[model samples]
Target: MAELLDNDDPRFAFAALKEYAANSGALLRSHIEAFGFSGLETVELDVNAAKGLGTLLASKRYAGLVLDRYYAHAAAKWLAAHPTLGRLTERAARSGAVDLLLREGDGTLTGDDLAQEILEDVLRTHAPNLTCRTALILVDPPASDAAAAQRERARSLRASLRALGIETALRVVDANRPGISLPEAPAAEPDLLLNASVFGTDAVFSDEPLFCERCEAAIPSENVEPKSAGGQRLPEPRLLVETAARPLRSHLLIEARRRGIPAVSGFELEVARARAVIEAFLGRPLRNCVSATIERDIRLEAENIVLIGMPGCGKTTIGKILAQRLMRRFVDVDELVAQHVGKFKARIYREEGEAFFREKETEAIRTLALKTGLIISTGGGSCLRPVNRALLGLNGRFIWLKRPLAKLATRDRPIAIARGVAALYEERAPIYSSLADRTIEVSSIDETVRAILGEHA
Candidate 1:
């Protein structure tokens, strides 16, 4: 984070990350939230593809990372062929654990520097929408023999997060073993025992907490989102969570629920502290810090979604479908001009010349971009104007609905006439690529609409 990009392509990391996030929603969301965030949503960035996400939210918000061992070591091992690691990477690639998010470095930095980068990124997004009372952390799966060294790195991260007004915890756990153990409850028996029988009798004995060699998966949590994959009800937060303390440390934590609390896993504690920080920063209770997914009596606000493409690339056709799906009105700039000027689009192009038409097109795109949130489609050349590109980029996302020229055979935009039809494809493809958060390859209006909604929905 302290060093600038040594190359001209500074957005390299951002671009790589956007692609990962776009495709792997479940993984990205889980890892980011685990790092301590109030809320997060992925967006198409005009930044680097290989870039990692870093935000300094408002003062008092918690920000940090919950990383795995693979992220810490793969860079040192695989020099040429490695991407960042995490749930998304695990599910998507499934080959190895690599860093899905990494700063621009030799990838051989000391753990302290790696920890610094993680804290910096999360804190960058921590203001206004976030409160300053947050902390960041770096979680590593137990891998290194140097436990003391790892602890020092974690300590450095904790100090940094605290400097940003966050309380932090760094942990390393053995993924292959039962998680770290703590003291027992007063009366409630430990769900996990080093070696216990079903009837609470000793099956076998060991100094370690009992872990079943037979069971493959960790027990599910009842309240975790999307429910359990096995559909089994999750037991209450026991073992790791204390039932004796006031105000729950977890399992649907709320100030009102704090009572007879117990211990919590490092991950759970980091999350709890992060949320608490957000609440304090916002001057609201922790219960109110997180956003709700439920629409809950929400009123629809008119929105503007402007589609920008070179020319004749199915903007009108796709725009109509997207608007219908969104239940918002649609306006095609070329069609709107034809309707207002009492002339066909081609007629206006021929009679008024390209310059005059471009002026009108620019004004229409500008106005449409500003109007609350209606969906608007622009002509192929609309993106040639920087204003149009900025409007689409800043106000909302840009979807470059495209296909091979073979797929666009009969499409007719102005560029089709002045130059050969192939020329249109050659000229605008790069700009379209630059302008879009995603380039959905579609052969028709319907497919294009589906792709757009697929991401937005």
Candidate 2:
């Protein structure tokens, strides 16, 4: 396994990212943090609205590299090495690499839980970039107790940032779950060695590998079976001492002298974060960032953040974090259902038709502009209608709440209904994305919260 690097080193991956973009007309929008050096401009890309980075790529001569969004490490390496596909990317570069990165190529929506069907459709049939140089990589927890016990038994994101009270700072690992090891010899070393989020999981990528105490022995669900893909029994670590002891001790030593965090590994952190999520789901009081108030006016100073995403993506929880971090109030539109219909929000969905819920949602949308110092969380359906979106955009900073549809299994919200959840998510995702001024995928409540406060995210 590769090792994750600390930020102390000059982040060189981004330098390569910039060089590639400058060599060609391409520009990239990705979760991987850009370094201190500012490029030409920092404009938001509408990932939910459209597809086809070729035309976009053709437009710029700068050679910027987009962070591989969806695929895992093996896929990135394979695509990077493809003979014909690799040539096409080079041709695009020769043609004067106009576009840099396709931000949302990882999932359908950029950072929002907006529409993905159209974008996915285009990618499936028309994508020339599918086998391009960019590839998404996986960095999952190990199938062991180490994976489970660290950071209060939480995964990477939840463990590290949550302890710091960084709520909105959800971790977007560069590598995907059940991580793929990088192949020897392909592209040279990266210019910018930026590890976007603290850990490298399915949510993101980095030049170095990430270490999480939790992943040492925790086999991913897909790989839980004893039989391997090659018709053989796969190796399983019987003890943390053998599989994880060395790695854990090695990283632990570095962290101790360099920057030892309270958690065991990044993956362990995610599991620990479940505490905060559970608290939010139960409507518990929120925590503060350190003792100091960023500014009481932070709430007043904060522009409205309109959350858009598929169902069960933690919009409300993230909203709560943003509100707390900014020292503002939090609002969940679903909470109003009980006030409006004399029934709990879920019961309202059960008794009153979804249409009735929409009607009430519209009412909530209209009320946003009149208020300030509030972080508003809305239902996935709320962003579907143009009228509701218009109301949300009025002096609001539209943000997409992106998360894998699969993670819903761990959540207990009403939106976690089993059947057709993906379909419903597909239907509403694009609409939510269309309205977002900025998009951010919610990997964990901690990472999401950290982002709101403008920390290491």
Candidate 3:
């Protein structure tokens, strides 16, 4: 039995004793007597009795004592009998490395709920020592929604631990499948196992040996059976003393910490709370990491200054001026669309149909959106499509160049000739208004350039 015990360290032995006692509802004195340390009650409160009890608890027999709950109470008594042992056990129990194993079952509780409950239980059961230490959260993947919620909860739990200065990691197990292999060795070995599974009985009976081998920690489960694989006995892992939660509320601050950003949740309250907590912990203002990332993306995306309006609205002339003033390359989306279809926009509309031309236009806009620091001039009806509007918005500051209907150029414009400038303007005015970040009523190219550059500056 002594050889069968996983850990030889007296501190782990004592902590295991207390855990066993708590679970089995056994008395500590009984375990001490069972371990062949008799007459503890009769022994006087002197150095000799304390010495004897310490030696016995620290002996090889103490290892065997942790293997069975029958010896748990006596182990607890051994700790109580010696003040130094009791204190040492308490500290080890609190600060030691903990591995949590969660089982999957037909329970109404979500994975997150189960995780919260188990974490709370572990923290409450083992505190101070368990606080600010590494924890590995393992659970069987649940149903789609439940799994998503569980991942979210795990993310929150990680954040909460970081807030408390604890390092944490998460892993999902397929418990129903046998011979599940770990991706890689864990960063650190755990000191204790919290088996929070519905199939707790089966896991303890069949899996304890493997778990003990990998973790060198005691399984805090009531069910236990001898390890046998294909009529062959298995050996336990090397045990040593050197080894090694809250409702894990996810505040917005936790999300920000995870993203290395500020205001990730987008809700004012959550962002405020996250900001305050992070600032206090970091002892400085929360850097706008998210904003910085977006700015970087914008730079990469090459968001150009885009001018849009009807054909005769002086978009080309104004676009070139704006480009020169801003020292950016100028591009005409209409020309790009023409190049894509291997013909002019009017020819594509006439030959292939308006739908094909619209597709070409959309493709051109998407390509243009990937460019940065440019001045773009768009055709009359580009803002009509919601997709084009969205794509352009992502990479450009949109400005609609508005001109009176009578002055609009309809000579080479097929759409203007077919639909008439007044009708086109009436039809697209609302879309242009909706899409443009800013609108400049066109007076001249110079004035328009100033307005656009003023906004840019």
Q: What RMSD value applies to candidate 2?
A: 21.7
- lDDT by residue (tens digit), candidate 1, 1-457: 1021122322212112333343323333343343344233233332321233222111112222223222333322232242232122221122222233322233321111222433334444433333324332223343543343344444444455455555433323332343432221211222311100011011111112222222233222211222223321122222222111111111222111222323232223323333332332233553332322111101122225667765656777788877888888888888876776778988888789887787777666555543444677877777776545544432345667676665554544555766866787777788888667667777656666777776456
Q: Per-residue lDDT for 79 in model 3?
A: 44
Q: Highest lDDT, which number? A: 3
- TM-scores, all candidates, are 0.37, 0.34, 0.40
Would you list the C-alpha lDDT of every candidate in the order shown? 0.40, 0.38, 0.45
Top TM-score prediction, candidate number: 3
How good is model 3 by TM-score?
Answer: 0.40
Q: Which ten residues in a row have the lowest lDDT in candidate 2?
A: 237-246
- lDDT by residue (366-442, candidate 3, tens digit) is 67654556788998878777556545654466788888888888887888898877888789888788767788888
Candidate 2 deviant stretches above 4 angstroms: 1-302, 409-419, 455-457
Provide the clashing-pair count of each candidate structure: 73, 97, 13
Worst 10 residues of 3 by lDDT: 239-248
Q: For candidate 2, lDDT tens digit of each residue in 1-457?
A: 0122122332122212222333211222111212112232332232221232333333333233332122112222333444333322332222211112322322211111001111222223323322321212122244432222221112222222223232211112223333433432222321111122223111112223333332342211211322223210111111111011111122222222223222232212211222222222223422444102322222224346667777777888788877776666788877765676678777776777677887787776666643544678887677766555544543356678788877754343555464467777777767666556677877668977676556312
Model 1 off-target regions past 4 Å?
Answer: 1-303, 409-414
